[model samples]
Target: MQTSVIISTYNSPLWLQKVLWGYFAQDRHDFELVIADDGSSDETREMLAAMAPNSPVPIAHVWQPDEGFQKCRILNKAIAVAQGERILLTDGDCVPRRDFVEVHTRLAQPDRFLTGGYFKLPPNVSKALTQDDIAGQQAFNAFWLMRHGLPFTSKLLKVVATSPFDEWLNRLSPARPTWNGHSASCLRSQAIQINGFNEDMQYGGLDVEFGLRLRHVGIEPRHIRYSAIALHLHHGHGYVTQGMKERSHGVKENTRHNRLTWAERGLSQWLDSSNRATLLRDDRLTRF
Candidate 1:
């Protein structure tokens, strides 16, 4: 089945470029990349223009006007336009391993959404990484990360283990299989059926809330945290606020308590409204 990788990004063009390079080197190239841009400047568009031509897979830019952290809105817009049977969710600041897409594809199953984890890097290592590092897959190696400033930790096993060992670790992991935006995958139709992400949410538990809704509808979650890994690039969470996080948390609690299956302010709301987002299709960079 065709897959679409929906990545959310604000302005971080430099990090976004690194993330794209990781995808360009993916072992599997059947998926499309959709940039769910949340009101970034022309700099981001320019960067996408420069990178789109040489991309191994098709690239689509679904952008809305920047009006604060409307990640949920932009993501819903991207999902509406995505042309894939399955959708993999991620961020612009996270670089994937070469096997990232392959692992997600191999693990996808009906009525189940896959949730993975990311190994976060410090600011120095994040900035120090080059396209070559990601393309060569050294950026994902625990030894390489440690040599470059990441302190050794038992968690390094996430990237160090392979095959049967990784599978065993994944099954043994206690981390809940939630809809993490950093690394997650589900059927596009299932996402649409749940009405996509809640547009009222900011950051915080928004992803988890979406996962709760999916569960309410009988869709199960599966852990792939050890197998499908992403190297999360360091970036400031200046957009986060105590109030917003608390509000997002409250919404999540409501979803869980009420067994909500559809987002009140999600995809369908955007589609029914007059507001529309711009789409960059093919190599033309033309608005659609």
Candidate 2:
């Protein structure tokens, strides 16, 4: 099946460039890239425009106005315009391994959403990474990370572990598998069935709320955290707050108690032909 990878980003053009380089190095190529831009400055637009011509795959930059932390809304907008049969959701700062797309395609199930995890780098490691490192896949190497100041921890095993062991660990882990925005995949139709992300949510638990709705609609969560990996570039979350977390919790509670399956305001609302045409004509979204 054709796959569309939706990368959410703001103004982190440098990290986004690294992530794109990772995609260019992927073993799998039958996919397109959709950038779900959340109102970045002109710098981001120019960067994307310059990179699109030489990109390994087709790229679409779907941007919305810079309303504060409207990630969910921009994602919905991206989902609205995506042309692939399946959609893989990730952040622009998360660089994928060469086999990332291959693994996601292999594990994709008709009635389930694939949930994966990321190896978060320290700020120093994140800053030290170059496009060459990502293209060469050194950024995902356990030894490379360790030499660059990654602390010694059991989690480090994920970088170099083999199949059965990784599978076993994923099965045995206590952490519940959920739709991690940094790495997750599902059918485009399945995402539409749930009406995409709840636009009311901020950065906190928006992904979790969307996953919960998918479960309510009978889309089971499949754990692939160990199998399909990505490297998360470290960045400060200046927008996240206690109030945001509380609000996210409240949304999660309401969805669980109410068994919400569809978002009230989602992709359907924005997919209107006239609306999409206007968005494209107004310089809000540019396809390349």
- Give the C-alpha miss distance for residue 157 in model 2, angstroms: 1.5
Candidate 1 deviant stretches above 4 angstroms: 272-288
TM-score of 2: 0.95
Q: Which residue pairs of candidate 1 clash?
A: none
Tens digits of lDDT, candidate 2, 124-215: 99999998898898888888998999988999867887788878877987889888988899998898888889887886789999999999
Residue 258 Cα positional deviation in candidate 1, in Å, after optimal superposition: 0.7
Expressed as tens digits, the lDDT of each residue in 170-249 for candidate 1 is 89998888889999999988987898999889988989999999999999999988899898999888988999999999
Deviation (Å) of 215 in candidate 1: 0.6
Q: lDDT of each prediction vs. the true structure?
A: 0.87, 0.87
Lowest-sum lDDT 10-residue window in model 1 = 279-288
Give the 10-residue window scoring lowest on summed lDDT in candidate 2. Answer: 274-283
